[model samples]
Target: MWTLVLNCGSSSVKFALLDVQGGQVRLSGLAERLGSAGASARVEVDGARRVVDLAGGSYAEAFAVIAGALDELGVRAQVGAVGHRVVHGGERFSAPALITPEVLAEIRACVPLAPLHNPANIAGIEAAQAAFPDAAHVAVFDTAFHQSMPEVAFRYAVPGDWYRQHGVRRYGFHGTSHAFVAVRAADLLGRPLSELNLVTAHLGNGCSVCAVQGGRSVDTSMGLTPLEGLVMGTRSGDVDPGLHDYIARQAGLSLSEITAALNRESGLLGLSGLSNDMRELEEAAGRGHAGARLALDVFVHRLAKQMAGMAAAMGRVDGLVFTGGIGENSAWVRGAVLARLAVLGARVDEAANAAAVRGQSGVISAPGALAALVVNTNEELMIAQQTQTLLAEQKGVQA
Candidate 1:
């Protein structure tokens, strides 16, 4: 049976059709620029790529285009389940849920926690349900994996009422990627996930680190939202709470304006005063750009710092796993970050690090050093697997 996984953003939808038993991607594509003049859908199947115009379209139109493409490709009858990636489940959902009216209402209640993401996610879930009413629909939450965090790790040093009344605490994001990479790391090490302790770094446009012990998340970098962890492509990771008041008083900037700058104009872009892309920053630094060099330095330094903290959470680190764009492709970044972690016995083979790039997976640790690995993450595949499992459980219960 094939499971359809959908990741809906504010203006785009990424999808994959996976053979659940074999764990193979049968069809994958993206719909971009939805609800705009440039809207289009691109689908890849059977080693061929096709693009369909969806100009001035909505999610419904985008789904139609995908369905039409599947029909043309003769795989329309293969879909058995639909998986929707919901960004935040708040404190409620701890696992992938079969979508019912009650579950849908619970998801709707989480809109306030993820104002910019959950609404789009809900829309995608509703649209997919309509498009495949016969198929079982499951909601896979990004926050689900981190629900294993203990109270001490997730709580803030704030008034008890803030957490008790508002649900304000460290509800880590990137739980899917973190959980996927942790299991992949265990596989690469030829060990069971429940027997290993790992620190996972997911470095991309957005960055987060996770500490996993006995196959469960103990601590993660992101908190309450995606903007609270390691420095990212645009979002400032961690700033003193007082800085907001300072900026407001000294620069005459409104709270909203400051919030926008921190979310959009900060991070690598703000530090380098150039591009947010790590590739560009690295190139500029090589050419003697002071700001770029500083940005890279700060990024590496902060990442290493957070990684060490993750190790502390696990008490002992059996391995270190790197994923996402920067973590997988940038040999320099892997080396730089690991250089700081030598104190923890984390040392990478320079040659092996160079060889592990662009979706390549391997152990880059020097002989006898703590195992360090580069594992490519597949959040979509993970979601599909979870969806398939949930559907089977539902069927068994009914039977």
Candidate 2:
């Protein structure tokens, strides 16, 4: 069976074709800068790659391009299912859902909670439905895995009405990544996921750390929104609530503008006054860019602080699994974070750390130290497998 995993952003579409039976990704690509003059798709089909210009295409057009690419690769008709990445499921969905009118409506109800992400998710789901009408379309939520978080770990120390009426509580993001890495970490450590207490950090442009105890997310750094986690490529994570009010009164800025700045104009970009790319920051930091160095320091320290907190949520640390772009590629970042995590007994082997980059997974910790492993995240594959599981359940029900 083949599955198509689709992740739709406001202006981009990321897709992967997985051979579910073969247990491998057959194709993957990204269509970015949609609704723009320079819109294009960078596609990888069976180890071969190419770029196709969309020439100012809409979201629907982007989906069309993706579907057309799959068709050219002769895998379109073989697509058994389509798994869509829906960012915020809120409290309504705790597992991957077979998308129906009712499930679609439930997802819509979550739009208010994720104004920036859910709308685009809906757009992708709707477009993928139209493109692959014959295939099963399932929604794999980013918030679903963290739904296991206990109340004490998720609840904010705020008013009850705000949480009861407005749903103002922690709903961590990057759940699929966290859940995927937890199991992978267990495999690397030669332990069962259900027997391990792990802290999995998904450190990309947007970063989050999760406390996985016995294969369930007990707690995570991100709360309610992705903006509440570690310092990201462009997001200011964990600011004092008073700053919002103070900045509003002093700078004469509206609450929305302040939020927009925090979400877009902050983090490494704001601190370095340069780029949000971690590779760029590392290079600039090496060349004596004080701002870049500060950004890296803050990012590393904040990550270590959160990792330590996540470890505190569990009984014992089996391993600290690093995934995502920065986690997988940056050896310096791994070393820096591990250095500060001495309290957690984290000690990295420099050779293993350097050798773990470029999508290779390895044990990076020193001999007999707390296990620090780099596990490459395969979210699309995770979505595909979840979609397949739901399909099997549906078949059993029908029979």
Candidate 1 residue pairs in backbone clash: none
Model 1, range 22-73, lDDT digits (tens) per residue? 8888788999998788899888986799898886669998898778767876
> Candidate 2: lDDT over CA atoms?
0.92
TM-score of each: 0.97, 0.98
Q: Which candidate achieves the best TM-score against the true structure?
A: 2
Local accuracy of candidate 2 as per-residue lDDT tens digits, 17-96: 88877877778889999878999888987898999888756877777777877888888888989999999999989999
Clashing pairs in 2: 171-224
lDDT of 1: 0.92
Model 2 sits at a Cα RMSD from the real structure of: 1.1
